[model samples]
Target: MTQRVPHVLVVGGGYVGLYTAYGLRRAARKGRVRVTVVDPRSAMTYQPFLSEAAAGSIEPRHVVVPLRTVLSGCDVITGRVTGLDHGRRTATITPTEGAAYDVGYDHVVLALGSVSRTLPIPGLAENAIGFHQVEEAIALGNQVIDRLDVAASQRDSTLRTAALTFVVVGAGYAGVEAFAELEDMARDATRHYPTIEPSDLRWVLVEASDRILPEVSDSLGRYALAQLERRALEVRLDTRLVSCVDGHVVLTDGTELDADTIVWTAGVRAHPDLVGTGLQLDTLGRVVCEPTLAVAGCRHAWAAGDNAAVPDLTGEDGALCSPSAQHAVRQAKVLARNILRAIDAEPLQSYRHRHVGSVASLGLHRGVAELYGVRVKGWPAWLLHRSYHMSRIPTFNRKLRVVLDWTMAMFFRREVSSLGSLQRPAEEFRRAASSTAPRAS
Candidate 1:
């Protein structure tokens, strides 16, 4: 009888998952282990470029990596792992279709990332959108352009004002970059409408925090607030959206602004399902792992990235690394090497990386960056934002495509067509059906 190969199941295909799988694949080729990866999405998305993608600075396809193309050597399954039978060393997975199946594994790595954290704000779900996925970014772009159309055509001031007003809630990197980029695009896009000018548009940013881009230096954060305010954007720090009904956004400052579009990019939390796993978790609900990145007491399982509470050895005691891509990417490499060490019976290594500062894009040739204790603003910071992220965007193909998009954007205007139809695919059919319904005879 022939002996069977030992199986290792990896859940998720995000940044942490992709890098970890890459290491495992190399190890499997040299040994008798079979690696399997499961994720609902067919690709891994480099989320940092999402703001650029939304503003038409980079092509959407360039930021995503198809897992099937890169991990051809591994058994790839496009499914969601619903349950883990740790005692039996098996996991239950549910694909887009078909019944769930239990797959046995000798080892498991849970790299499932964080989701957009939300609150019980009134009318948010119905009126606001998120900035997490490619679809959301694309849809938001389309929505922004479509609002200009309504503003240009409507004669009533009430309707016109509502159409031109847009609100963004959050001051983090995602929200600030996205708000600045979209504001620039929307203002420039109005030129094509002829009837609407940049002055007629209203952009409001509501951040409950004391300052925007808290990860950056205090001076740069203040600089960002000034830059945005100069562009006529309402930067309401220490304020929040209390309620938004239909097209009106009510703020905590007792001000009501009528806006047709709202975007929510406040922050993210660890996936709530992690709670029931019985895995050790910290106060933040992130998996509690040792410095080696292995889950406490779960001998055969390990975790890292946004879903795990990784220690900040560079900081003093009782401090943890902020949940961001900077830490997640480094953790992935360390986690992968540690897992290999465990397999080969070598001493496991600990994760140790220092903070490298942060950067934020504030639309067309404008930005803020703080690197290695040096503060930058304006065009120099913008260049750094592009240069640093360009190198970090995994895969040469994606990097090349993004570079080409930027190169083209330099000489030509950003594309301004709003494919609003993408949001409601059946709108045309519904209109036709209603029109041909015998006139309510």
Candidate 2:
């Protein structure tokens, strides 16, 4: 008689989905299980390196892992999971250009990651862009450099000022790192532009909270704030963006400014698709999971990453793990092991690992880090920041490529060219089509 292999279907190919599939590959080879990963994108982005990619320090190609290549032993589907009926153990997946279909699974892993959480601020949806995806990071670099070109060429003061001003909302890790990296890049590129000076470029960091880098220690956050202030960046704490109508920014603190660029890195919440899954979720829409990373009251379901509200055994009372890469990567290991144990009739273990630390790169050779309760700042922290993330990025091939990128960068000046035209490839063709139309009487 032939043996049956348990099919494990994983949703969303972000950090958690990639790692979960990666962990299960070896087990699948042993004929214990069959793993399949489904996501809208065919590649998984190493989000930790996105800021550097935007700053032109690393090539954008090296920051993503092709799901099929990494998960060779497993089934990889480039599609979105629309509906998940867990009671029937079936998931409905829709491809880019086809009808939705359902697939059955013995065990399902809910690793669907978070999306940008935005409020109903005016002109936000139309004007501002989020900084979560690799494409956004790449486009941000082009947009900033392109703005410099416009500012330098424009003769009008208002036009130049608007082109040169850059506003960044949210002071968390993503917000701070993106602002710092792009600001540094702009500062470096100013030497090439005869009409533009570094002093003329306005960089503003707005945060509604009292301090920046809230994930780190108070002292470290203060240190980071001082460092940014030293660079002449307007750090407006306890302030909110009241309106950005017609590219004119009005702040609650009565500060008004005209800017061409606004990057939103405010925050992210769990994927809303979970709301349709009929699973137990917290008020925030995250799937409620036990300490062992299993969906509570679901026998064959598991959850992790930003979409899961797993109890934080190591933190304060009734605290859930923060939706950070550190927790997601670590939880993937435990979740994968618990799945295998469940299949083999072994007892499942709880996910109780404490967070090691967090490191942030504030442009080149500038950063702040808190590791194992020991705080570090400046160049050493910067080195630690690069080294730590380099080690965490999956696959030796990607790691080697990243190291080579760093090695080549040491002997060369930064590249500051803009490829913003790539975002609108058909613009010229459309203009040509419109110009050749028949004339009216």
Candidate 3:
């Protein structure tokens, strides 16, 4: 009888899932196991660059890692795994255009990523866009620039004000960075508008928390606040958007700000699908794993990243390594190694790491950083902010391109051409076809 190779099924191609598979491929290929990865997206996104992608500092396409190309030797399936019957050792995968099938696996890696955390705010779901994906960030940049043009040409003051006003909900890394970067880009864009001054622009950053960047040291948060405020941004602390109706933003302070652009980056919660997955998940739908990254009490299953609540072994004080990409990527590496060890019948290891610090970009050439208990600000912090993340921007192809974009941006102007067509590719064609339609009236 011929020997059979073990099948390893990985769900979700995000950082944790992709890296987990990538790390195991070299070792798992003793001609013993085959790796199969499934994800809805064709690529993995480096989420930290989302803010800069929105700011036109880096090309959007470069921020993504094509799963197929990167994992050519591995089986890549583009489908949604709707159900998992771990006991039956089978996963029900619904392909994009085919009937569902049951794929049996010897081992499974769950890396389902997080989704945008939302609240029950009026018109938020329909009116506001999220910054979780590259498409959203790039579309937002186009919208911000296009709105600047619309505001400049419109004669009506009411319409102009609404067009120029912008509201960003959340003061975390995503919200703060997006707000700062977009505001900076818009300020520069306003230079081309003959009628609009930078003062006409209204940028409101609303955080329900008492402080912005609460994860960072208090001093760094203060530095960020000072920097944003110096640019005349409305920093609404301990405040939130109660409702946004037709772009009329009502804040918790009983204040209403009119704006056309409303960005939602409040926070991220685990994907809600894990509720009935038969896996041990936390209250937030995140799979609960042991210190060794194995699904608690479940054999042959493992998890990491936003979808998994692995114990933080750093002996931290009231912390579980908040669901940040920094932790997820590191966790993925360790989880991968442990998985290989598990296959080889070796001892598993515990996952432990301290969150060193946080850094954030405040507009152009300005930032704040807290590393090793030391705080930094101004251009140096900004440089560190760029350096650290640029080094972590997935593949070398993306890293080189991002650095080039930044370097070129230093001497030349940012490319503001909006491919809004990407959002609605056939918009013009539809308009033309409709205009040519026979008039029924």
Tens-place lDDT per residue, model 2, 1-441, is 998899999998998899999999999888889999999999999988888999899999999999999998999998988998988999999988789999999999999889999989998887888999999999999999999999988999999999999999999999999999999999999999998889999999999999999999999999999999999999999999888878898888999999999989999999999998889999999999999999999899999999999999999999999999999999999999999999999999999979898899888999999999999999999999999999999999999999999999999987999999989999999999999988999
Point to the candidate with the largest TM-score. 2
Error of 1 at 6 (Å): 3.1
Determine which window of 10 residues in candidate 1 has minimal summed lDDT: 23-32
Indicate the worst ten consecutive residues by lDDT in candidate 3.
313-322
lDDT of 3: 0.87
Q: TM-scores across all candidates? A: 0.96, 0.97, 0.96
- Which candidate model has the greater TM-score, 1 or 3? 3
Candidate 3: regions farther than 4 A off:
28-30, 316-319, 437-441
What is candidate 3's lDDT per residue for 81-145, written digit by digit as tens?
Answer: 89999998899988888899989998899988899999989999888999999889998999999
Over 4 Å off in model 1, which ranges?
Answer: 1-3, 429-441
Better of 2 and 3 by lDDT: 2
Please give the lDDT score at residue 344 for candidate 3. Answer: 79
Candidate 2 stretches greater than 4 Å from native: 432-441
lDDT of 3 at 36: 89
- Compute the lDDT of residue 80 as modeled in candidate 1: 91
